[model samples]
Each structure stands twice: as structure tokens, then as C-alpha cells.
Target: MDMQTINTFLSTTAIELLIKVGAAIIFWIVGRWLIGKVVTLMQAAMNRNQVDPTLTKYLGSIVAIALNITLVLGILGYFGIQTTSFAAMLAGAGVAIGAAWSGMLGNFAAGAFMLVLRPFKVGDFVSVGGITGTVTELGLFATTLLTPDNVYTLVGNGKVFGDTIQNYSHMPVRRVERTAQLAGSVDPLDAIVRLKAAIAQIPNVATSPAPEVNLLDFKLEGPVISVRPYTHTDHYWQVYFDTNEAIARVGKEAGWPAPASTQIHRVTQA
Candidate 1:
């Protein structure tokens, strides 16, 4: 009520606000420095361990965000703001958001599972959810794939995890299986033996497993000779192409008849 009392009250309030402000500024600076050091150390550890780049970056970002958030809340609390109440409100809001974005949360969960399980890693060619490509990046919500055509594709982790994942590059060796079609007149038993021998000549085909050739089925045109060749995954395409070419060459030399053409004759009603 008095002028002196009013002046004293105003001075005290201003001094307290200034002190809180100064302390907040100091805390922020110190906290950020410490956070930076911690993050740098973490990155160095990851690099030393030969961790995947994608995972390392993701982990660092998450850690940085969490630390920064803690710093902000600490600063806010220093200013006499009720951070506990704020956190409670945020938790409630997070629950609502989690429910609202259930699908996105599912993707996050799936990504976490994928990281833990290590089903496939970057640079591995995988088939999931009908999309086959090399995994370029694995994010928190989706997996980025570079298709054979060089097109970038994004598949949600939730869907990919739910579906089957076939990692063709998981192992060092890959088996190339092909069915060579032959004309009905061709004798498969003899040709199968010869073809297997010819396919074995390919240098890329591995010797440990040994090449195999057997008659798979009898179609309208001829017998289908199943060919299984083992080779290194990196040289898969070359082996596949060379094996296919060899099959044709061997089959032709063995007097295997060519496929008969299918002629569709549609006569209009007169």
C-alpha cells in the first residue's frame, strides 16, 4: 500500500527474475557443452565398434534430442516454472498422440524390433511386402530401399515386419536356380546329365556344393530341366547369365528342338 513497500517489492521481484534468468543462461551453456562432449564420445565409440552409419546417426539424434529436452526443462524449472506439471500435461498429450497415431507408433515399434533382431542391414538385398531392393537406409518409421532400377522406395517398418523378409544377401553364397525349357521331342535323361556337366564348367559356379541338373517337369513343349548352381552373392548376376547362356548352348548342341510358336487365330462370326 505504501510507496516504499511497493518499491521494495518491485526491486526484489526484478532481482529474483534476473538471477533466475542468469542462472538459466549459465545452465544452458554448460549443459549444451556437456551434451556435445557426450555425443561426440558416443559417436567415437560407435565408429570404433564399426556400427552401421544409419543406426549410429539415429541413435545420436535421439540422444541429442533427449538431452536437449532435459536441458530446456531444467532451465524452465529454474525460472520458477512448474516443469513437473508441464511434464504431466505433456505425458497426457503424448498418450493422446500415441492413440491417434497408432499406425506410426506401430512402425516405430517395428523399427525397434528390427534393430534388435538385426534381420537385415544396409546394403543387403531383401524382398519384403512384395518389394525387392537393396536396403539403403533404415529409419525410425520406414526402411529405404534402392530398387534394381535405381529407384528409391520407402516401405513402412510395420508392414515390412509383418510380412516375410527374404534377404538374398544375408549369406556370402547364393544359389541360382533355373528351369530350362526343352522341346517335347528332346530326351531329357541324357540332356540332363550333359547339361549338368556343361554348367559345372562355369568358373563362377562354386565346386563345394556341386552343380545339379534334373528334369523338373514335363510341359506341353517339353521337359523342364531344373538347374541349381551355387556361387558367391556378389557374382550372382554373372553366374546366372553365364549359366543360362550355357544351358541354351548345350541344349541346342544336344539337338533340343526350339519352342513351337503359339498362333492365336480368331475368326469373326460370318
Candidate 2:
């Protein structure tokens, strides 16, 4: 090739390279700033709606990433790169990744739904899918809890929403049930009447509902007395402890022994 032609070609290549480099850097900086703004907006929106902090942070990150990707593609196209093929490749790769992590995605979707619906919130005691604990944190894929014994547990959001949730803290009032065994000879009618009176006197117990005392069954030891009473949820523990003590004291004062099974046998020798 002639020297003149070589020089012209080199000049064009250098200019093109500089333009591409400048475009990429500008796109990166502007895109990052814009995504940051979007994330801030998302956080503001979440805060306005009282969304959980964990979920708000996760959603903001996702929005930032999506914005960054879009800006990157636009910048690439400005440098004369064909984005159709690139977009297709991205879509294909995304599909593969999505298929591979389908379970995780389901958890993410479920977590989003949980965030919106708010079936339970942090600090609430709930039982779901056989796991009982107080909610500590909620995330896109999992929810963390602290058990009564203070053990940390992480349950997937998908499983949590998919299964039934027993929210013990949802209501202002809760019922406490206790089954006390007595001698079989104890009169069920008298025992129930005394239990009702005893439980009634306990502080925080709801008088409107009236405590229920039922003879559940007669066992080898005694009759099983199912004593249930309604109390304010906040005073659940207090009522539970008081009611238990009251039932025992009342039964003793009423002259009724918890029932017990009786057996008799005879032996004859020839």
C-alpha cells in the first residue's frame, strides 16, 4: 500500500477509536448517575408507602441494574454497534439464567407479593409451613425469623406464601387453651363450673366471650378438662400463667380431684 493511503487509514482508525472510547466513558458516567437517581426515587416511594427496609433496598438495586443495562445498550448503539444481535444474545442468556434459577425467581415474585400484601410484618409471631417464629427480616428470596428460643431461621418466600400462615399477632385478642387431667371420679359438671369462675376472675381475661370448660375425654389418669379463655393478645403470657394457677386452686377448693382410670383384678388359686 502507498504511504499516503496508509496514513489516511490510520488517521480514520484513531479518530474512530477515540470517539468510541469517549462515548463509552460518557455513557458509563451518565448512566451510573441516572441509575442512582432512579434508585433514590424508588427508595422514596417505598418509604412513603411504609415498605419494609429489606424489600425496599432489594427493589432499588434491581431498578438500578435494569437502568444501567439499558443505558449500556444505548451507548453501544451510538458507537455503531448492532444491538439487535446483542439484545438477542442477552435475551437468550437471560432465558437460560432464568430457567436455571426458576426456584429463586419464584421466591422473588412471592416475596414481592408478600411485601405488598403484608400478611405479616417484622416482630409479628407467626407459624407458616410448620415453622413458628417472630419475623426478623424479609428479603426477595427468603424471610428471616427468631424463634422463641432465639434461633435464627430463614424460610424461602415462595414456601411461606404458598403455605398457610397462622398469624398469632394479627388480632387484638387471643384464646389460651389448657387441658388439665383429673381423677376419673371427679364430677365433670362441677369441675367445669368452678373452672369458669376461676378463669373469670383472672385479670385481662375477656368476660364477653366467657371461658369455655369442656370435658374432653376420660383417660387412665382422669378426665381431661379443656379450659379455654380469651384475653388481650398483649397479655397472653400473663393470662396463660394466671389461668393455669387459678384452675388448680379452684379445683382443689371445690373438692374435685382430676379424674383417674380405675382397674380391678382377682386371682384364684386351685
Candidate 3:
């Protein structure tokens, strides 16, 4: 071809490429804005219906991801790229990734199941997968917990769902199990009465079941007094510590000697 004709051809090709690139940019921006709007609307609707915030956020994330993927595919199609082949490639990659990240996929599946089962919600105090803490977030692949010691922990949802889950906040009240040792000379009946009165006076103790102060067992040093107080999960630690102090206070006021084991040695001449 002559140089003039070659130059014209090159100019047209470059212009077309530029226009397509510009259009793709605009499409991406618009697509992203629309996805955000859709997610916001869906979340608002869920909130209006009083859906759980954890579920609302989770669903929103899923929907946003799906829409973003669709948008990317659409953009690829606009550039005259065969989306069918691209989708096939994506499917193959997904399979490979799924195989390699089986545990992550399991966690994702468990998270979905947990959302349906509603075992525990965010902010619930629970012991799951051998970790005890308050749930901070129920995520796509993991559950975030804020422990009693102020540590944030992430536990795989698969592990959490597979193991025993104890929801301390499920019931209205939880029982704090504590035992006190009394001097062998101390009266068991008197101790029980004293403990019951002290535990009842502790703040946040439940009134319905009342505090249970009873003879648990006999130790070598003293009689064991079971001092169990029922309280809301929120106030559990407070009530627990207070109950211990109350036990000590009662012992001090009663002037009961600290329990000590006495062993006798028999000396024999053979």
C-alpha cells in the first residue's frame, strides 16, 4: 500500500481504539455506581424489615461481589472479547482455586449455614471452636471474636460450625459456678445460709432462680460450699468476682479459720 493510504488506516484504527477505551472507562464508573446503589437499596430494605445487621451486611457483600463480576464480564464483552470463553476460563480457575482452598470454601459454606441457623449473632457471648469470646463480626469465611482479655480473634467458620457452640447469652441468665472451702470445724448449714445471703446481696444477681448456696462435698481441709449465682451474661464477670469477695467477707466476719489438712503420723516399733 502507498504511504498515504497506510497513514489513513493507522489514524482510523487509533481513533477507534481511543473511543472504545474512553467508553469502557465510562461504563466501568457507571457500573460501579449502580452496584453501590443497588447494594444500598437492598440493605435499606432489609433494615426496614428489621433484619439482623450481620445478615444484612453479609448479603450486601455477596450481592456487590456478584454485580461487580457481572460488570467486568459486560465490559469485556463490549470490547468484542468472547465472554463465553472468558467465563469458561473463570470456571476452570474457580475449580482450581476451590481445590487448592478447600478449607476456605468449607468456611464459606459453614458461614452461609450459620446465617441460616442463627446459632449466635454479633455481640453474643459464646464459646465456639474452643474459643470463648463475644462475637464481633460474622464474616464470609470467618467469625471475629473479641475475647475477655481484649484480644480480637478470627476463627474459621468451618471449625466454629463443626464444634460445640455454647451461647452464654442465649438464655436470660447464666449460672456462675463457685465453691468455697470452710474450716472442718465450721458448721456446713451455717455456711450455706451465710453464703446464700451474701450472694443474694451481690449486684446483678438473678432473683427468679435465686442464688444456690448448698453443701457440695467434703474436702480433707473443710466442707465445700457450692455458691452459684445466676446473672445476665453482661454482668457475669462482675457478679462472679463479687461473689468470691462475698464468700471471703462472710468467712472473715464469722471468724472462721482457714481450712487446713491435718495428717497424723503413727510411730511404731517393730
Best by lDDT: 3
Displacement of residue 241 (Cα, Å) in model 2 is 4.2
lDDT of each: 0.87, 0.86, 0.93
lDDT of model 3, residue 191 = 87
Ranking of candidates on TM-score, top first: 2, 1, 3
lDDT of each residue in 39-119, candidate 1, tens digit only: 989988998987766667778988999899889988888777889988898789989999999999999889878886789
**Model 2, range 1-270, lDDT digits (tens) per residue?**
999988998799878889889878987997798789879988998899888787788888888878877998898888889999989999999999999999999999999999889999888888976799889887878989888788999999999999999998898778998987887777778888888888888999998688888989878887788999998766788999998899779877878764556888889999
lDDT of 3 by residue, 1-270 (tens): 999988997799878888999999999999999999999999999999887777788899989999999999999899999899988998999999999999998998998889878899989999999999999999868999999999999999999999999999999999999999998999999989888888888999999898888899998898999999999999999998999899999999999999999778999999
List runs of model 1 lying over 4 Å from the truth: 1-11, 43-50, 182-185, 218-223, 258-270
* Off by more than 4 A, model 3: 1-50, 53-84
TM-scores, all candidates, are 0.79, 0.83, 0.76
Q: If the candidates were sorted by their lDDT against the true structure, best first, what order would they fall in?
A: 3, 1, 2
1 or 2: which has the higher lDDT? 1
Against the true structure, candidate 2 reaches a TM-score of 0.83
Which candidate model has the greater TM-score, 1 or 3?
A: 1
- Using TM-score as the yardstick, the better of models 1 and 2 is 2
